[model samples]
Target: MAESDGQERTEQPTEQRLRQAREKGQIPRSKELGTAAVLLSAAAALLMLGDALGEALSMVFEQSFRLERAAIFDPATMMPALAEAIGGLMWPLLGMFAVVLVAALVGNSLLGGFNFSTQAMMPKFSRLSPVNGLKRMFGVQALVELLKSIAKVVFIATIAIWLLWSQFDHILRLSGETLNLAMKDALELLLWMGLALCLALLPIVAIDVPFQVWNHTRQLKMTLQEVKDEYKNTEGKPEVKSRIRRLQQEMANRRMMAEVPTADVVVVNPTHFSVALRYDKDKPGAAPVVVAKGLDEVALKIREVAREYQVPVISSPALARAVYFSTKLDREIPDGLFVAVAQILAYVFQLNAWRKGQGNKPVPLKDDLPIPDEYRV
Candidate 1:
């Protein structure tokens, strides 16, 4: 609901979750659309059957009733029954139409999934609002729809003419054929005609599906600033994020300093730098790492802590500063400092000899030790 730096948001989505869902096949597998398509083909087939059968059925029914010259044939008597029959047939016809609709829904499920809504049926006074009505009247959507309808009409008409002309001779020449042959021919003709209709419909599907997908995607797009706002809604404020980062750094520093008390030595600048190192013969691959380090005032505090804890202290000002600033805790000492550190370590071990009652504490500040300029940190 506010804004955020774009860093926290997803960039190129692999859409892996969506892909996995597809692999799992969670979407509806509907036959409704395909069934509707086939039923539409069947309806065309039925129309052909109806055209050929209507005359024969009417003749048979008339003769069976023997209503040659009677008032029973009169509209006055039969019209009411006819209306009653039409009324009686209406509900079943509606039920059948509902089946066709269900077939369409099933087909949609097969495509991927069926998404349904009834929002259009809500009681909306907006439908009656004059301002909205005028907007709809002149809208680009309305203009586009009008043009689409005209194009549809022209296209369907052209297809109808072409198909019917191609079948003209067969359709007109259906006299000598038996009823069985007639019905069979009609069905065959219907199948081919249905296929032609599908071919004709191909252009509409090809043009519309991709266009609809493109338009829908565009509708969902946000400006870069709007993208930031959405991220804020999902994540949190920038100040809170900054505070979190600060807490993490403080925790890491505290943890690093806390380990210094266990260190065997706290090498220092004697006033302004400190690096605490630890070694274990068990881990020979890594000689030592700076467990803790600090500068200036913090460096003095480290020296005080080392003294209070009675850990050995060695003064190497430049090395202490270099280790404090350049090296990270929990990592091996830098290559340039290794030899110098080893020599200091050797002296410290000899001092260890003095503390063990086998020798005496060596005097401090000897120039004889191989302390080099680059090794001064």
Candidate 2:
């Protein structure tokens, strides 16, 4: 049994959920996806930057090595080659962008049934509030952001230290060379630095991906009123209690008649209402309760099935209607009819005892209750 609190608890709106998620330092914010795009984009940008520096050093290093003649590197001759190289690389770069875009979309989708809304962007002048700005600066979210920054610095420094140790021999090797050679070497170092940067940024990326999803879910939260509205839409408007009761009774009658087998007796109106009653012999002084009841054609089906099952069919029209109208299935017979029903049950039990050849047991019942002649069988 539920205690009546009279207040129904419903879900909160998406914005509140998002605001809470954000406060908790949950990751994968919307901008993080954009950040992933930037990271991947940086990879391509680094490649180009590395290439330009490499070419400048190539010019100086070629002269120092005395290996070949320097035909001044011309844009006109190299432009086509550059275009060809870019075309070759385009597929992979596009794939990288696509992966980030899809990951962001999926993470966002899972966090909430994420829906895009510009409503969040529809103009706010909250920047004027110095108090809110101060709160944001000192908030839990600000703390998380500060932690992420510290982690990135630590990660990058560790990688750089490792790189220095690994490349110490090369740095010490005396290759009599010019500024071009130094620039080329530095460019090579920067290429590795880009990778280390991406690696260092990975934690922030991981964190933000989840936050983005959480942020999206928060935007779609359901307020109490919205929860009720959606439920009503799904379940349809509530029906009157009386109508619900009637439908329940009708369904019960159909089910009851289907279980006419194994009943001890069925009290009937001969042509109108029929009710099948069953009693467990273990229970004493308790009259059989109605298991199935029907009026009109359904009543006829109950009698037909009762006859087929060879259950005793007692014609007691007044009792049949009284029990059918006054009691519910699986409940005890009502107080008013307890004595009359007990006698009928006793008579039925004696008949069963006689059939089993136990003894000649006399029917143990009294006359029926007085009722209208029209309803009497």
Output the number of the lDDT-best candidate.
2
The Cα RMSD of model 2 versus the native structure comes to: 13.7
User: What is the alpha-carbon lDDT of model 1 when measured against the actual structure?
Assistant: 0.65
Task: Write one digit per residue (lDDT tens) for candidate 1, span 1-377.
Answer: 12354433223222343344345443333232364455664555445444444444444454446544564668885676556545554554455466557656664564555544344345779889999999999998689778877886798789988999999999876666875566557666766776677667657655655664454334334445555565686567989989999899778767876787887788887767889988775775777788888877667767788888878899876667666766787776877777767766766777888889877776664433444455444
After superposition, candidate 1 runs with Cα above 4 Å error: 1-164, 167-210, 217-244, 270-272, 334-336, 358-377
Residue 28 in candidate 2, Cα distance off native in Å: 5.6
Error of 1 at 124 (Å): 12
Expressed as tens digits, the lDDT of each residue in 1-377 for candidate 2 is 12254433335544445555445544244554455556655665556555664564465454436523332366664566455556555654565566556655664454334555555545657966899899899987799779877876787788878877887876665265566676677666666766666666667667777775665455455556666676666556667656888899888777787778867899888989888888877887766777888789888988889989899888877888888887787776777776567677777878888999986877545455644444334
Candidate 1: clashing residue pairs, number: 16
CA RMSD, predictions in order: 12.1, 13.7
Model 1 Cα shift for residue 287 (angstroms): 4.1
